[model samples]
Target: MGKASLLTSERRNRSARGTQVRRERVRSAWLFLSPLLVGLLVVAGWPLLRTLWFSFTDANLTQLDQAQWIGVENYLYYQDGAFYGVLADPDWWNSVYNTLFFTVITVSLEVVVGVIVALILNANFKGRVWVRAAILIPWAIPTVVSAQMWLWMFNDQFGIINYLLMGVGIISEPLAWTASSSLSMWAVIIVDVWKATPFVALLVLAAMQMLPSDCYEAAKVDGIHPMRVFFRVTLPLITPALLVAIIFRVLDALRVFDLVYVLTSNSSSTMTMSVYARQQLVEFQDVGYGSAASTILFVVISLIAVVYLYLGRRQLGISS
Candidate 1:
């Protein structure tokens, strides 16, 4: 009976120890997670909540303390005739059209040219290291510097571009690339494409380098065409990485400010949403209206990010 009683006591002690260990584990997990939760609340949550509140109120920079709870008055103003007039204005529409046009043309060309460049860089060639370094120089240059360089190149009177074109008999007179609204947008697109294509190439080239060589050897053994192998095997394998690169480029294009601001000086033909919001908020000092515009842009970009996340998860599952 004494032996049995001692066994029961031992079992009780083991159970108690297990429970204590579990409690300690739970406590440690919470301790580790606490800082991250606090950081998210402070950095992301607070700013978003504040922006939403400001969007609803008349929170101008000067009247921030005395700002009234207008309750969607700013949003209503955006829907009113004057706001609609701004929305419907030819110059506003032209800017929107130009922004979209530039994004599409530049991104499309970049992807195509970037892929070709990546393919060439993937091959074993003489001076390949130097070539890669040279390609990255354009992307490494500051946007402001790039803009100034392009501006100088596109100058009509003393520009190298005009001199070359005139010397080649392409045109008798110097052409002003930035003077006309129609040409100005394309000029900006060309400069953007030149500066960004290297980024796309590097990303794709990295993905290509990580691909397994055995698969390509198998394709060769099976007598598959090179183009067919690329489409069926290479593209499918690297799609997730390519999608990530494209999404980044898309977001960058949407928020484009520095290059456009420096190149065009917020001209009606080149004014992006960021330029417009900044002009109203900082330059014009219409804080309430500017906050509303910025809030909308934030929401739209957030939605795009959410969509990319969903698609990325779906692709991951498929790849797995």
Candidate 2:
């Protein structure tokens, strides 16, 4: 063959090999991903799809087998030139408000207290090992167990919290911490912060340990205040891990059920979205409404995730 013909053949051969290599890589990726994809379908996707179907039907716990297609009757309605639905339900709105409030308070407290705890544990102090182990104790407790424990602590009579307050002359009467409308939500937030702050602290501590010491050393050389260094250097460096911790807490807080349910026993004041959904699904036997609530909860959580991810990326990209 001529020189040009030989060169063209070689180029085609190289292209063919490249295509084969890419095909093999794609096959390998699928080989590794197949198990996880199967697991997700079995564990999450199938149930979600079924729930979506139920949401659009007249499903109920009492007659689930005989459920009929009602077509969004549970989600929307029109009454004399007005629009109403779960979106218009005052109880649904209340639950949404309670859930968001609980999430915001607990996550904020956890992040702040977590940073302080992490900073303290990061220092070379006496009993640091024991303190670290103790910090994990609350987090290691089962959620139901922790909720029951807090319930006792917040009891109107014979509770440590009341005992302490009375001893300190803070209150003459033993207060009903979880029974009152105003205090019940705060009670839940406090319990959640107590239980979960350690996890955040430990995560942040791990991130802090991984941070380079050179930055701190340089900050010291410039005679910067410790507080200033934390904000200007440490926070920026730990943003990625902090974001992870925040996201973890946010997801958990948004779906909180056991703690509030166990502590307050479905009091409207502290009823969260998860609790409300369960009440409709299991107690009230309104499966259609319950599934709709669950679907809405999922959308709310997805929006939160997307917003945080977008903000984190935008902030990080700018800083970089």
Q: Per-model C-alpha lDDT, please?
A: 0.82, 0.92
Q: Considering summed lDDT, which 10 consecutive residues are worst modelled in model 1?
A: 80-89
lDDT of 2 by residue, 41-118 (tens): 999999999888888888989888888888877788888988666787899999999999999999999999999999
TM-score of 1: 0.82
> What is the per-residue lDDT of model 1 for residues 1-320, given as tens digits with 9 covering 90 to 100?
99999888878898787799899999999999999999999998997777777777777777777767877665554553455323444544565566677677888888888888999999999999999999999999999999999999999898999899999999999888877777788888889989999999999999999999999999999999999998999888888778877888878887788888988887888888777778767887767666776776677678988998898889789888
Best model number under lDDT: 2
- Regions more than 4 Å wrong, model 2: 1-29, 80-84
Q: Candidate 2 at residue 31, lDDT?
A: 100
